[model samples]
Target: MKTIKILLSFALTATLFTSCYTEVVVDDFAYVDEPTISLNQLLRSHELWYVDINSTLGYGETPFLQKAFTVSFINGVVYANNNIAGLGANGDGFGIDVGEYNAYENILDVYHDIDGFSTFDVYEIDYNTIELYNPNNDTSYFLDGYQRNNFDYDFVFYDNIHYFLQEYEAWEKTYTSEYGAINEFDNENYLQFLAGGNDSTFRSSQDDTGINANNLYWDYTGVYGVGDVYGDAYLKTLTLDYDYLGNEYFELSVINDGKIELFHPSSETVYEFEGRGYIQYLKSESGTKKEKVQSDKLRKQRKDKVANPRENTRKV
Candidate 1:
């Protein structure tokens, strides 16, 4: 009787283990129907996948996808546009290689250089839209695929203008419209939009700092926000809340890569600021042989130009 009981217990344990293993294998590759195109071909079919950050639905973060505005999969490598300065021109529109990825059955396994391994279940929602669901984090990021020529780089830049403001150490006042009533903003000569720490912090200085970003002194620190103007792709609204000066509002527009124009509705004044101490993030060494060589040369040029910090700064 005891021998029979032992045998039964062992059988039950084995059955449970087999059941769990089978469930895992099935879950990993849930779509049983044979795909018309392999996952590799599907990912590489488009030149870029624009991560719609606002549409993300989950609590957890997925490494590179969370930070990148767009992700590209090509030749088993992963590239991302982590900055807005050179979105359309960087790496011939491929941006920087952040890691390598492998796609099999409907699963994409990425090994990011800094964030390490992550697994995502890919689902095609439509012809241009696809959902990248990270099972580990219970997060889903919807990406709209586009070719290099079709992608609207301007829209992406205006949509994410907040990050662009933080890209420079300081914005020096270069132009202010002759018209409009004089207000407190006229006294503000420089503005600094910072990242981290709540992500909306801004500082203003009345001193003339020129292209020397580090020399600027903060006279007032405040919180600022950028809001979109409905129906207009290029127009945005900015508001700066100061502790002593109350709230200031303006119509913001990107004049160029390093210049921003803010139209103050209250005073009817237009202010243009030039970015100082421009920051460019991440340039990896992985890509095609030619791309790698080009990146190397660019790195050498940057090294030589590092002696003059103002080389990247521009006057409006």
Candidate 2:
């Protein structure tokens, strides 16, 4: 009877121990009630996250997030595509390494080489959409995840053509088609698009400055803008608002890496401009300008051909 009681007690103790161990294993390791996918896995799943700046809802801005057109997360490294000039070709399409990041649960902690540390609450909006909300700044930025194999780089390039114009110090008149009628634009030789203080700022020069941006004499300063042509991605309309000469509109086309063609609809002439003094932004890991060749020449109004009334060639 004593042996029987001892055996029964041993069996009961073993059963209790086994039950406790199994419960811990299920709770800690196989907790199905919680999300199975880790934050690291979710971030690493996409090759690129296109920062939808227009969708952003907040007054405060994130430095890194504000500058990046697209960002990528790969093996704890953060990559960003800041400029549109070399969109598909830079950093093998992943862009330059801006910083490093760590993921935990639904939070992402980034240590940018330039902007320092920033934390974001990662919320998965859908299968390919995520909202990165910065609690410190009360700002939320939406990102659309995409795989490299199916990404449309041309669309992105055309969508952000304004930034592309500002990449160069100046654009020199390189070629002009003999097809269009002669007009006052023939007197123009150089065009410079600026980035800051209202992105549409522009300066024009009639002097044959060649490829030297410093030697160029700006004759006119006004506003310039790039607009879409009836929701078309490939076609864009450019408007140069000259204060005295009115607005000059043209059909803008990027001929190549360093050349752009402008079609004047009224004169039916084609003008090709070559980029001079390229300015590559964020060339280093710490977000520094790579090659900036600024023109400090004095800006003045052009005295020649000021009588040509502004004509509405096409509606932007």
Candidate 3:
């Protein structure tokens, strides 16, 4: 009789363990609550423009004389320009003129306002040539007029303009993202939905069904253009389920520009605002500049040492 009782107890324990260890396989076709917030709404809510004044030079001794400007983007191209001008009206200054190369090439007599001073007869040259000019002091610099067949100033100008526009677009996209996040928090239904989930996921989509899991399974086909808002046609998916206490846990995914991104609710990745080039390309440009600067500094230092070897040795 004791053996029979022990066997029955063991059977009951095994049954309990089996029940607890069973895994629930959610059907691929199972229905999940659709996201109330649209992808456009999310992007618009979190939209932001991260502006940084890289280097600012003023107009004169007190304010500054020359200024360089650069605008970086996350989704768009980067634009950069150097403002060349003098301190006073009588002082020499540089002017920029962008037009059809044929018409504007010989017409170096461009006009513009430099620090509130209206000046005429500004010179127009290829950006490459302009890069060689010194902005600090008055120096006579000239661009060798190239044959029409040999030079493509129009192409260069177009490229520069395109780069600047790209940077502007990036700023706009960032601003939209920041605004969207703020709006998401303010929406009562969205917040409640978020709070109720134990494991919630969010993703951007274009499908109208508003289901999160479907978005994951579906092939992403949304193509974002410049200045496109998140909600215009694109959609966002949020997947979530609540624990016993109803604390929310969620996952987010969005179709940004052209790519689909899966992001954690708590962790957001902000790429450094680098313009439209790979790290290798940027590194190459930066490396070249660094090398040039170092070479120049070394040359100066070597000259000093040669001039006064004893004095230089003591300082070193």
Candidate 1 residues 63-90, lDDT tens each?
5686688899988889888778777988
Candidate 3 ranges beyond 4 A from true positions: 1-111, 114-136, 147-149, 153-316
Number of clashing pairs, model 2? 1
RMSD of 1: 13.9
Give the top-scoring candidate (TM-score): 2
**Per-residue lDDT over 1-316 for candidate 3, one digit per residue giving the tens place of the 0 to 100 score:** 9999999999999998777665322332233434334322322222121111211112211011122221111122111122111101101111111111111221122111222221111132332221111232222122232222343333332222212222211111121134223422121111111101221222122223323321223222122112222553232323332333232222222332222232224434211111221111011242231111111110000011111111111111
- The predicted structure with the larger TM-score, 2 or 3, is 2
- For candidate 3, give the lDDT of residue 22: 58
In the predicted model 2, the residue pairs found to clash are 180-268
- Between prediction 1 and prediction 3, the one with superior TM-score is 1
| lDDT tens digits, residue span 1-316, model 2 | 9999999999999999999999998997766567868999999889999998777766566777877888999899899887788888999898888888999978899988767899888888899999888877767778999987788989988988887888888899988897879999988999999875567799999996464788887989998888889966788999999888878999999987688999999999999999887775556725542323322211111132122222222223
Question: Model 1: residues >4 Å from true position, as ranges?
Answer: 1-32, 285-316
**Whole-model alpha-carbon lDDT for candidate 1:** 0.79
- Quality of model 3 by C-alpha lDDT: 0.23
RMSD (Å) per prediction: 13.9, 12.6, 34.0
| Global lDDT of each candidate | 0.79, 0.80, 0.23
Superposing every Cα of model 2 onto the true structure, what RMSD results? 12.6
